[model samples]
Target: MASRILAISGGKGGTGKSTVAVNLAILLAENYDLVMADLDVEDPNDHILLGVQLQNEKPINIMLPFVRYDDCIKCGVCGEVCDTGAMLISPNGLPYVIPRLCSGCMSCYFACPTKAIVRGERTIGYTYETLVQLDGRSFRLVTGVLREGEEHTPPAVIAAKERALLTDGDFYLIDTSAGTSNSVATAMDGSKLVLAVTEPTPLGLHDLELILQLTSKMGIETWVIMNRSGLGPEDEHDRVVRNYGSRIVARIPYSKRIVESYVKGRPIVLLDPSSKEASMFRELASMVKEVME
Candidate 1:
């Protein structure tokens, strides 16, 4: 079966995109094969939130420069060719390579005349996979965790996505980082559809607009899910969101029970599928299916 990759994204943090992505994948796994990937490598929380113990933690390596001191010409060629400023030429004309700023492009190594630079691998993050059982349906949860002090989230996101692509499934639910930067863009690339989760608060509205703007520019079809809906009533936020021409596929009302279940690491759908929040998610799944069909 053709895989339906759905990217869950929001421009700002604390919008519940990962919560929705994980639960939606669990819900869909009841009748279809599903693989849920947490592409937010900088702060991966899906596995923790799901209470799944990851077993296979594999290191993600990226290229770094290894200077061959014996072959060095002290020409400062590597520093000049680094586009990311990873290599710095000191006042004394000595080159210093900063591993963090390096994008693993290896351009400096290839451009060196004396072959003084050699390409080496550095561990930037780790990719993990685990099997989670939700409501008797078993599904895979894969995530990438970037090491502290690392600025490359896009590479780790790509590593997690590559692992997800290896699994054959009916659906791939990708939970992206909360931003408009390269990390979010890398996760959403090649996705068939995107679900932008937002809240009714002022900040939520602003970030939702930003996310919508970015997604529209990518030519990707998007649907919005307004969380904590009815916090203020009168559908003011709904009207404002609709003005952007994107339909609100679902609205999960603010509920203490939903929050409590999430804190307890239990799927709200399992708590009571007939509850308001659970029903809202079900409606969301149905709407997505209709669109994909």
Candidate 2:
């Protein structure tokens, strides 16, 4: 059978999405095989949260255009079709490529009427696979890390997700970047269920609606995981979830123990299995298992 994909996402940053993901993975792995994918790309920290180092590194490269001046007929067609302005016309009427700005769409390569554009490649990021073992139980962790200066994130997100899907497992749990952008959508694709993590703040509620909008449009069943529930009033958040036809699956209360575990690179479920936070994650994992069954 194919793996059932479950995505954890939020529209705003610092919403404890990764915190929920890693803890849930530890709990769920106890019974069923799980492959946890950290598709944030820009800053994937699931491996860090699991206290594991990434292995099996692989590069994510995209198509680059190289101008061959020898066969040049500077028709300026490449520049005209370049959406990102990666193809720049020089003072002498020759086209050159700005590597950093290139999205590797290959529009410049095909638009060159003179066939002066040659194919090249550029590495935007890398993907990694790590085996995390704790108390003799393990799950495969796939992570995507973007280069510091790279702005192209969708490709890396897609690459990492693809890598995760290739691994065999009973459940594929994805932790996406914080936003409703294309990169986040790419990670959420094919998800059986999406848990949109949010806080109780006004900013959190505002962004929660945005992510719910995307998930609703995608026709995926979404559930709200209200992190830091006691920080502020969540009456508005409750109404917003009802408006979107989704329900709150779990509410993780703010606690100093959770913070300490996170700071120490240990999941609360493992650091303090008897804690309330750990129990919440265990219950969440049970819900996921029921869905998979």
Candidate 3:
């Protein structure tokens, strides 16, 4: 059978998206050959949590605008068209490019009548591939890391996703950047299903609704994982999930053992496969396999 991409995402950060992704990948690999793609270019830490070094690194660059003074008109059109404020008109009326602010959408370039904008490449991030072996089961992990100063994340996310697709696997599990912004959409673009991880806090529920709205628009199946389930109000969270037509497939309480496993650079699932936490992940994986099959 051809491979499918299953995305694990959440609207807010620190909700354990990466942890769920790595553990689910580890368990799923037992039944199906898998590749895990970490698309959170902003703060990728799957390798850290998995305790594996990234291999086959590749730099990713984006197009930066080069302004030609010769063809320049003092027109404010470039600045007006720049959504990211990368292009700005100086006091003298000439537009200058701010590389960090540039999303490389080329909107300014297209909107410029003088053709003063030229495309230049800037190395913004890197993509990495490594093999992770756990309990005699191995799977490939592809991670995208954005440079510290880079503002645009979608390109890096796209680059890492493409790298994961090149590998041979029965299932490609995608760990997306937090939030329901365009970058997250880029990572979740072709996913077969999305496991949306969130907590029961006010912030968590707020962002969860936003992501659910996005996925509903995309017409993708999404299941909720109530991470840190006992931290806050569950009734409101349940109402929100019910309103979105998404079921809460799993609930993981905040546990010190989970924290210890994270600190020790080992998945809790690996620490004791027979434990309740590990069984939760295994059952989830089994449900996914059944659905996909």
Highest lDDT: give the candidate number: 2
Task: Write the number of the candidate with greater lDDT, choosing between 1 and 3.
Answer: 3
Judged by whole-model lDDT over C-alpha atoms, candidate 1 comes out at 0.83
lDDT of 3: 0.89
TM-score of each: 0.93, 0.97, 0.92
Query: Candidate 1: lDDT of 7?
Result: 91
Candidate whose TM-score is highest:
2
Tens-digit lDDT track for model 3 on 27-146?
888888899999999999999999999899899988888989899988889999888888889999999898888888888878889898888889999999899997898999999999
Question: Sorted by lDDT, highest first, which candidate order results?
Answer: 2, 3, 1
Judging by TM-score, tell me the better candidate of 1 and 3: 1
Residues 85-141 of candidate 1: C-alpha lDDT, one tens digit per residue: 999888876778889898898898899899888889999999988888866899888
lDDT of 2 by residue, 1-293 (tens): 25588999985769999999999888888987889999999888999888898999999999988988998888888889988888898878899899999999998888788788899999999999999998777999999999999989998998999999999888899999998999999899899999999999999999999999999999999999999989999999999999999999998999899999999999999999999889889889999889877
Residue 235 of model 1 has an lDDT of 65
Instruction: Report the C-alpha displacement of residue 284, candidate 1, in angstroms.
Output: 0.9
Evaluate model 2: give its lDDT.
Answer: 0.91
lDDT of 3 at 221: 93
RMSD in Å for all candidates: 2.0, 1.2, 2.1
